[model samples]
Every structure is written in structure tokens, then in C-alpha cells.
Target: MQEKRDPLLNITTASSIEWGPCDPSVITNPALSCSFFEIPLDYHDPSIGYGRLALAKLNATQDRLGTVFLNPGGPGGSGLDTLNMLADILSSLSGGFYDIFSWDPRGVGSLTTPGEIFCFDSPDEYNVFWNGTVELTGIEMTGNFSDPNDVHALLAQAPIMQAKYDELARRCLRHSSGKFLRYVGTAATARDIVALADALDGPGSLVNYVGTSYGSLLGMWLINMFPERVGRVIIDGIVDPTLLATQETATAFHELADADKTYEGFLTGCALAGPQGCPIASAEGQTAADIDATIQALLKQAHDAARRNTSAPVTSEIIRDELLSVIESLGQAALFANTTWPMLVAGVQAEAGPESLTARRSTRSARRRTRRSSVSQQNQTRSYSNEAILCGDSIDLRRTRMSEVFGTVIAASRNTSEMFSVVWPAEFYACPFWPVRAVERYQGPFNKTLANKVMVVSNTFDPVTPLPEAEAVAALLGDNARLVRQDAFGHTSVSEPSQCLNAVMFAYFVNGTLPEDNSTVCEVDTDFEIFPGVNTEAILAAMVPRKIK
Candidate 1:
């Protein structure tokens, strides 16, 4: 029986696609023994094809089946890169029986076409557009964005960029080798993934996958479309499709609040750690440290510099510093598996002292002055990724009545969080003007109730996806998902190299044993520690092989 065609399918040029082995070096390190495959740029549509897919084959024994295909959460992040970063973890869990593999998605990583979409040719361009402007109360606080007229002019440029993107999309289809481009959507990608069991492994072989953040959405789509192919799939920091169409603003605001909570956790932990080199302080319970005060001072210095048109100001240095601090602080708990709290405590204390704050303020002032002069003469187009991914996946920002209802919240956040929140006002206007409406909307009754051996993990404090977001995911996944709460602060719960957390994840994936319902907590240090300690090897031993020795 002929199946009904997907209404969203783009039927462009119907041509044959060519597939061949890729340059293994492109994906695998020269030191590793691995091979790769290159699928034509246009996987489904032959006529609209240069885009190539680079697939990496891991070290597995003969008679092996590929169970795992890892995709990092970004709608734009490279799957191949994610596998490489987590190669050690993958090897430890899947063992010799499962072939672990990854591929560069279309328009990402090695398969990226000759276009300016993903790769910014210049670091300066990225820094300027993404990090250049300082906004407050929906006003550009510094540089060329200071005027309301300037804001309108910049917003007007999105259409021009959209036109350019349209041309690029058309060109990509016109020039490709096969009908592949038509099938690159998440649903199609899932189908292609299922075909791998046949292309690379024996009959009836399935896929065991690990997808995080945005990748979780893809995982869900795959599971819904091909439930039979799923084997020990782990969807970490899950995203509910139900929330994508209706509650984008609520989601964003919730995440920001979570970020604040994470920051507070870090600060409290830092205070306890005491004053050594860390700026925030290492002492555990103390109100006098006033880290909030320090943040305010830093911001005020920056604002003053901007106003005076001085050569140096606090805003420039502090913005970058704050961004790095939060990212580093979060990474420690999520990625490095270290108790960065103590170190952060020390760092904050050291920096917040009377002498350091003055120096930092002066340095920031200098940076602000320089940035002000440079950005004034520049004319650049903003990249579309920020809007494309968010708006595409979101419900509608307009439904929230953000500005009117959240005015008090925004103002309070600005006062409490210092100037950082003020510097980047929400892009409320872009959602209203998004070029394309979401083809499909996500509704509630998210699949939290699936009766599967599911496990969910999250940091106590996460900046981007945040704890609340994770909590929502847990609630949505319901009985099927077990929540593993790491006693840490960050964006992703398991990004930190926590032996205990890793053990739970590995056990669940390799042995099909989910953590118990309710809270299963793993403690991680707040700072990096290099010493002969903690027998993590035992946990590693338990997880390294899929089959018993």
C-alpha cells in the first residue's frame, strides 16, 4: 500500500544521489583507526544538491551492530564533534558489541556548504554583532544602537537577510546531486538513521541513542515515528514539543530565573569556600560579602564610562567577564564534574575586595570606550540563527504580553542582577516578524508518562535550559523519566564529569537499569581539583563494557 506523503515535503529536483567513503581524517583524529562515509549533499532530491555528509565509524569488533548515534543538542551543533568530545564516555558504555557512529548534519560541521550561514568568516563580525551592543529598557545603551531610530533601522535589515537566505536555499537545491535535501528535516533524519541498521549492520538491528537539549526533541520525533528502532535511548535535558508553539516567552523568562537561582547557589557555595584567590568569597553563610553589590558597582562603572565617552569603562570588561564567569561556573558543575563552588568562592572574594574592584572598573571603562568608537563606524547584518531556531521551535511570543505584564519583573531583575540583564533586553519584536510560521505546533500532554525505563538528569542550577526547564521536562516525561539531580550549578546536569552521575547514566544505557523514582542526587565539587583522590575508576569499570566480563 502506498503511504500518505508528508504535506511539508519539498519535492524539488528528482535526481539520483551518490554515496561514497569520506576522508576519514576529516572526522577521525589521525591517531584513531576509523572510517567515514560521504552521502550526497541533497540526500533525497537529486537535482538540488556540494553538501556532503561525513559519517564516522568507531572501533568495534566484527559482528557488531551500530546501536548509538550521538547528536549534541544544538539545532546547528555538529553531531560528529559531539561524538568526538564524548568518545571516551561512548566507548565506556557501548563496548565492543555496539558500533558508535555520528554524522555531520546538513549545513553543519564538515558538511557545511560554501555559505555564511553557520560559519562566520570573521571572529570580529561575530563578536561585534552578537556581543557588541548594550541594551537597556529596550533601548540601545551604547554605540550606534543608542537611538530608537537606529534600532528600527537594524530590525529592518532582517528582511534583506531573509532574502539572501532564500536565494541560498534555492541555490543549494538547484546545485545538489540528489533528492537528499528534501529529507533533512527531523522526521526524515530519523528515517535515514533507521536505514543505517541495514546499510551498516545486520537485519533487525536497532539504534541506541543519546540526545541532549534540543537533540531531545529530535529523539522524541524519532521515537514517535519509529518506536521499534529505539534501544536504550537516553534523552538528557529533554525539550517538550508541546511547549514549542505556545509558551516561548514563559520558557525564556523561566530559564532566566533559573539562571539567577543557579548563580545564587554558586555564590552561596563560594562564600562558604572562603577568601583566597576567588573573587566572590569562600565563606559559606554570610550576608556581608554582598556579591550583588560587587556586580552593581562593576555595572555602574561600565555605564559611567559609556556616558562619559571615556577611553575605559566597566561595561565592556564586565560584560565579557560576566559571560565567561557564568559559562565557566556552569561548565564546572555540568561539564567538568568538579566542585567549582569553592574555587568560585575564592575567586569572587579575591576580585570583589576593595583593591580589585577599583582596578577591574578602570579596565572595563577602557574597554567600553574602545568598543564605543569601533562599533559606531560599522555596518553589519545580524545572523538569523537566534531567531530561526527559537521562533521556529516556539509557540508565539506575543501570547505572553511580555512587555506589559513583565515590566515589573524585568525592572526588578535589572536592579537585583546588576546591569547584565539590562544590557540584553528580550528580542520581543523579532518573533512578531519571523518570516515563516511554525509548520506544526507542540501541544501539552507531553510524553512524560511513557512506561519505559527512562532517566532524567539536571543540575540544581542551570543557566540556559535551567532547573525549571528540566523540571518541566521531568514532569512531561512523567513515570517514564527518572530525575537524577546533581548537587551542582550549570546549564546541563551531566556536562560536568561526575563519577556518580556518569555511573547512573552508563548503568541505565548499558544495562537497562533506570534510577529509582524521586530524587537521586550526585554531588560534584564547585572547583577544579587536581590530585590523587576519588576512586572514579570503579564507576568507570562498571560502565565501560556492555556485556559482562
Candidate 2:
């Protein structure tokens, strides 16, 4: 029997593609196979050359029931890398009934689809122009705005930030690759997913997918854009599609409402772990007060250092932002059994040592503003790719005045948690000055009756993408979407290993089953404990290579 396919006229599609082995240097997975397929550079215009989408797939151990498309959100993150990282777990969870697959989306700089969106002539050029300036600074959680000094210090950088972005817009616009800006929007990528599915599963196969963070946004776009094609979709760490698509609201308006709750949870988790597991925990298993004091002192030291040097690397704000990151990445493979939390504690303790951070003036002087030599290829390209995708997909903010932009920042601080309001607004700091819009933007009536039910997952207390986002999205999706609340800390369900959550997900992927209802709740099997905590002499002795006797 022949399967049907609705090949997109705009994108170059196929019934089947020749698969090739992945480069051993880049990735060494026996189960993985890689391929590149062409899509339109400008779907609206054919004369514009084509861009290729790079895809990787983990073959099913059994006969493939279907293909599950996964995306690691980043507007710039490599989907292939995600497939590599989670292939084993996803393979096991689904019982290997299906092949797990993903691709490097356009503008991520990994694929041959114009490589990546680059505006600067060279890495050095980018560093030189951005040197000493907090241009395109991703929010470092420094400088709590409750204090007038911190608020003023934060607000003062608005001018310099704006000037840098305006210049960046100019430089990016003049660059040859800037022409690709319109081609990289989420809408276009949504189409690319369809094209890929058609090629892999004979054109019209149902699109089953799992997406987290920015990938969640892509999932929303997919279901709404091609509702009939949805087989089973799970979107976690959701972005409120309605809020993000609005021009007046600004990207920051989606808001990180649960950030404060997550912060509280971090302190609480430390308290729970006690003195043996956490550096800041109390000996007698007390409240979060000890943890708070330890952190507050570090912040004070950082703040004092920032006061002396405007360009200090470790500011109160940076510490706060890093803490937010530490919280978000709580249960990552490395953080789970490694030194993530302790290093954070030890790093701060070392920085905030006996002399109150004045001991570190040797490096963060006004003279050493240029971190040119320190810029890695990964950081530079990821930063550049992040801006290109985020800004390109967004409604143009170039027309918004600097004052209006600053107003959003101030409002985010007042309305949301002042502890991390600065962080959310800085997520798309480049958007307002972004010079291009993708060829297509999905301003949606996101609620559509789809071919299958959509599963929306959220951590009860996600640091960045709050539960309200998933709540609103699920509600908007109405009967078509099932909301599963994971009562866990950290950014998403991945922060904790939850047997309940995994079972629900596997059931959905294997058998198009939605949770019993919108109220379905899943509990994680573990909590956020410091990984490999402090090793006692007894524990160390146990680890020693011993004779059988």
C-alpha cells in the first residue's frame, strides 16, 4: 500500500532521501544517520537560491512504528545535538518502537542552509565592535532593583545598550547574509518540518513531536500552521504564543512570572539537602535563612566590586543571573552527579573572600574591557545565531523608541519579580533594534482542532517559562490539548527524572493517548539534590580500588 504525501510547492521535498553516516569527529553514535535536504531560501521567491536542512535520526531497535521529530529550542540550538543527547533515553522510553529524529533549523549556523546568519566580517570584527560594551548582553541576574542604587545602575546602561544595538542593526543590514534574515522565521521552519516529514515518512505521515523551551514555540507554530498533520505533540517550558506574537507587548511581555518561586525553591531545596549536601545549608536542618545570608553576602561583595569598576565581570546582577541559570539547569546530566552546585558556591565563596571582592580588582579594571581573546567560536556564533533567529522571527521593534523599550524593562521589574525582571527583558534585547523580519511570521489564532490531541507540560515552578504559559496555552487549545503539570522545580520536567511523567509521555507517543484530563498531574521521582554531594572519608574509602577480601 502506498502512503500519501502533500509535498510543499514552496519547499523542495522528496519521497525518500539517501542517508549518510554522521562524522565521527562531530558525533559518534552507531544508531545515528545524517542527511541534508533542500528547502527554499525565500519560499515566496524561487529565484533566490535554496538552503539545506541538516537532519539526524536514531534508528529504531524494532521495526519503526513511525518517526518522532524532536527539537531543542534555541531559535539557534542544534537539534542534531539534542537528538544525540536524548536519543538513548527517548529510545528507551518509547521502547524503540519509533526512530527519534531532529534537524538543525535554519539560521543556527550548523547546517549548510546559509551556514549561519552572520553580520560581522570576522570574529575579531564582532569582538572589536562589541568590546567593553554590554551590547546584546543576555541578562545576567545581577543588581537587584529593590535598591535605588541597583535600579539606577541598571537603568543607566540603557543608553549604551541602545547605541550598540542601533549600530549592530546597521552593520547586520549591510552584510550580504542579512538578506537571509527573512528566510529564517519560525513559520518557515514549521514548513521545513513538514517537508522533512514528507521525505522521511512518505509526504503526508502524521507529525509526532516533542519540543522544549523555544522548541515549544516551534511546536505551537507547527500544530497551528498545519493542524491536520499533528499526530502527537508535547510542548514543555511553553512560551505564550498569543503574547509572543503581539508587537505592542514586546517579547519580554510573555514574562517569567514564576522566577521568584523557582528562586525560593532553590533556597528551600538547599535547606532540605542540609549541611552535608549543600554548602549554604544549616547544620541543624534549618530554614533557607542561612542559604539566603550566604548568597546575600556574596551579592553585596559583587555589588561593591561593580561600584568600583563599571565593567566588573562578576556583578551582583551577574551572580543573580547565574543563580537563575544554575536553577534552570539543576538536573542536567552533568549537574546531577557533578560539581555544578558546589562550584557555584565555591566560585562565589572564592570571589567574595576575606577582602570583600576588592581582592579581585586585578582583572576587572576599566582598562581590560576587551574580552576579545576570550571569545570562543561557540559563544560568538551561538550569540549571533540567537539574535538572528529571535529577532528575525519577531515583529520589527526598530520603530519603538528607546524610552518605550526602557519602559518595558521597568514594567517587567515592577510587575514581575524584580530579582530577575532584568533577565527576561534581556532575552530579546536585540529584537527592538532587529533590522529584518522573517519572510513569514505566525501571528496565530493558535487554537485549532487538530488531527490529534497536543500534550502541554510545565514544571509547577519553572524559573523562566512559568506554568501560567502552559496553562493559558492548554486552555486556548481547549479540548484539543491536554495539560500535564509536573510538580517539580527547575525550568522543565527534564530537571527531574519522573517515572510518572515518562510513562505518560511514552504512552502518548506510542499510542496517541492524551492524559485522562487537563487536570492530570505527574510527580517526579527525585528532588533537586546537590549531585555527588560532599564525600566523607568513609564514602571515599568505599570508592577505592579494593582486593576481593
Model 1: weakest 10-residue lDDT segment is: 369-378
* Residue range 1-549, candidate 2, lDDT tens digits: 122322346655575777899866545777799888878777667677677877789888887888889887766667776777789998987779888998878876445475566667664676577665544223333434556665565567677767877887887878776777778888888988887787778657899898888889899999999999998789988988777677544445455687866666666556555666564654756666676776777777666665665555456655565576666755542342134334434444454433433322222211111110111245342135666766777765647756567667767767776667665325365677788777788889899899989899998778778888888898999999999988776777887678889999888877777777887877666433333342112221323242210
Each candidate's lDDT (Cα)?
0.46, 0.68
Instruction: Give one digit per residue, the lDDT tens place, for model 1 in 307-406.
Output: 4443232343344344434542443422211242333233333433244444544333223222111111122222233334445445544533324333
Candidate 1 overall Cα lDDT vs. reference? Answer: 0.46
TM-score per model over all chains: 0.65, 0.85
Q: Candidate 1: TM-score?
A: 0.65
RMSD of 2: 7.9
The TM-score of predicted model 2 comes to 0.85
Error of 1 at 505 (Å): 1.6
Off by over 4 Å in 2: 1-8, 121-124, 136-144, 248-253, 282-285, 311-313, 332-382, 527-549
